[model samples]
Target: MSFMPPWFWLLLALLFFSALAGWVLQRGLKKQALSADANDVQRQANRRIQQQHLTDLDQALAEGRLSPAQHAMARDDMLRHVLSDATAAQGNGMRPQVNAASAGPVRVVWIVLCLAALSGWSYAQLGAAQTWWPLPLSQRVQITATTPEQLAEQTRAWQQATQSRPADAQAWLTLARLHAAQNQHALAEQALARVLVLAPEHDLWVERAQMKALSAGGVFAGEPWQWIQQVLTAQPLHLNALVLAGSAAWSEKRHDAARAYWQQALGLVPADSDAAQGLQQALAQATEMPKLAEAQASQVVPVLTPTPSGGDTRPLIQGEVRVTPEVQSQIGAGASLFVYAVAEEGSRRPVAIWRSTPTAWPVRFGLSDSMGMGAPPVLSSLAQVRLVARISKTGSAQKQPDDWQVELEGVKTGVQGVVLNITGR
Candidate 1:
């Protein structure tokens, strides 16, 4: 049970802010009034000096009414008196803030205001940051849902908001920012992806992509590096992407590559931004790292070889699917996967074909050709792929998947090192 309702808090905040503003205003007014008073004093002093001169000249004329020389001398004396008085007046009156005692109230008000602000900020930091104690626990908590359905509902609301106003890049960015804040890497990735597709010229892609990269790599396990490469191809000066790329590389011990990427990006970003600072630091560290051997070991699936007479292989499986096997099936949370196989140890890569789920032969999970893993595939470019797969994103679903099966086919060339994860009963 609480007596303070929403309006009560609202009123309190309003009053608090109003008091602060009023205090500041009063101080400004006090300063202004002091200036005005000084100006008035100067004006009064000048008026007195002129009066004194007139009085002097009249007295001298009355006493020496007989001689022209004496009258002239008396008039000169009067002029001198008036001029001296006017100078004195100008010096004192023109100096603003002649009344220092009157400003005490204003100064006190400012002090009180500062103390009030400090108190409010302190209260907010302690009570709000941890737990709101003044109100009931139910009302005090900032409600965030935990159930899968609730997440979906919230995600749906965000999606609907963007859909209703497709042109709102800021809304998209806001949603992306929210997702990034929650470490919802998949959602953030989708949001950034939308930004790229909708507004290519938007200045936020590099930044958003950087956030996505960290979120994906740190918690969610998505294709952060690949997406970053895509962003880099489009925008070379993307600050976020560069920082993310460097971080990802350095994290995995690819110091040379990280340094190179950082050096490329350092000049394009704000000097004061954390990313730029990190770039400079990474570049310095990378120079001292001893180069490691090029990574070549990979578990590979087999590829079909073309017939010398241009004839198909004896079995359709020979040409239709790739033979991709991994060194192991188990991997750690942050481990990388590499896949590659050749007919001969030294020969070039082979073509990979696709097969449906529960295939009679080895099958890859994609719509087109290319057997590949992200880690190994990124290392080389001679590989061509025309494969696409529908992967479940963000894996937030609590229920088990219905199918452990997928399909793979070929388009132009086959890729290597990709692993298919399917879970079905």
Candidate 2:
């Protein structure tokens, strides 16, 4: 009933009134017709009686029961009496009664038809006819996930939906977010690329760019940088895009450009807001690094420009990597070694990274601020970090199921003689 159209009540009222009017008019006309029929029957009986009396008078006159003048007068009197009876009967029935009774049904029919037409018109003009129609079966039921298993099933369903409906941008977006939630950044980027092609929304472009950077080990260069630039060209004041552009510049060691981008974003946001505070912190870091390096250089007397081995004499964290005998036997000749550092808490993206293909175990490696994958959160700025060493069979940054790896937590910057082992799978 709540879904009924707004004009439904009016239509009901019209139906009631029309029915009432038709019933009342029909009942009245039926009574008048019955009465008129009764009167007509009575008048017919009287005429039959008068006609029989005239026949009897004529018979008596032929039998010589009266003179000619008497017989003629008797016949004339009988005829006058018959005419008077007919006139009285006509007066009893009203002059227009026949026409009124005949027209009553037509009036009732017209009233009903007109009300019906009006109800139809009102429904067409003021009501939603589609609301009364049944919904499709697909739309009537909704499925919601309440558990991890259900969520995984839902993700699979959306993946299938994207495959079946390749042109459906919404399906692609949902699949991308699901993959991202599961840390499958490479797949997320692939799905988001389709979304950009179909919709090309600005915010989605920024999200896709971020996902691309994540898929590439948090290095916002090449395509990711291009995506950010595209968004900035169209919408310079876009907050996320501006922040991303700054991060890209910072990763490339363009501190001044990073500062410029962050400053422009800061001016567009409120000073007391979280965004402004973050931007201020980034600016402060960018401003202090060069000064700190200058102070250290001044303090160090007779700093050598070159070492005997022609390598950086000072490194943030120097490490030696080793593999267990079981894993050493599995390592192929072309196997690559990857070492990375991440903050002790928060984001898992590596702050710095180093990659090499050493010929033997117990190889020495160094990670410094210059090895940072991105900036403003360099190795020197972190109080504590987790270092990881992995032997990759495919030489990819993304870890594989069978790769041997190990992690050391709570390691501080500038720590030396660290030993990392690839004993864990």
* Each model's Cα RMSD: 18.0, 13.7
Residue-level lDDT tens digits of model 2 in 1-425: 26565457657887898898789879988888878777767767887888888788888888998778988998899888887877776776633356767788898899789878887887678767445564422133233543448757878999899889999887888777766654467787898889878877777887788788877766787889998999999888988788878878876768788888888988988999866776787788667646655555544322111101113343378768888888888889988887888776554557677777778777777776546644345676678798988888987666677778888999988787788977869
**TM-scores, all models, native as reference:** 0.30, 0.52
Model 2: CA > 4 A from native: 1-158, 164-171, 177-183, 217-221, 289-320, 343-346, 364-387, 400-402, 407-419
Task: Work out how many backbone clashes candidate 2 has.
Answer: 0
Against the true structure, candidate 2 reaches a TM-score of 0.52
Give the runs in model 1 whose Cα sits over 4 Å from its true position.
Answer: 1-160, 202-227, 230-235, 269-276, 288-425
Deviation of model 1 at 173, angstroms = 2.1
Predicted model with the maximum TM-score: 2
Q: How many clashes show up in model 1?
A: 19
User: Once model 2 is optimally superposed onto the true structure by TM-score, how far is the C-alpha of residue 100 displaced, in angstroms?
Assistant: 41
State how far residue 239 of model 1 sits from its true place (Å): 3.3
lDDT of 1 by residue, 383-410 (tens): 3332222212222211114312223333
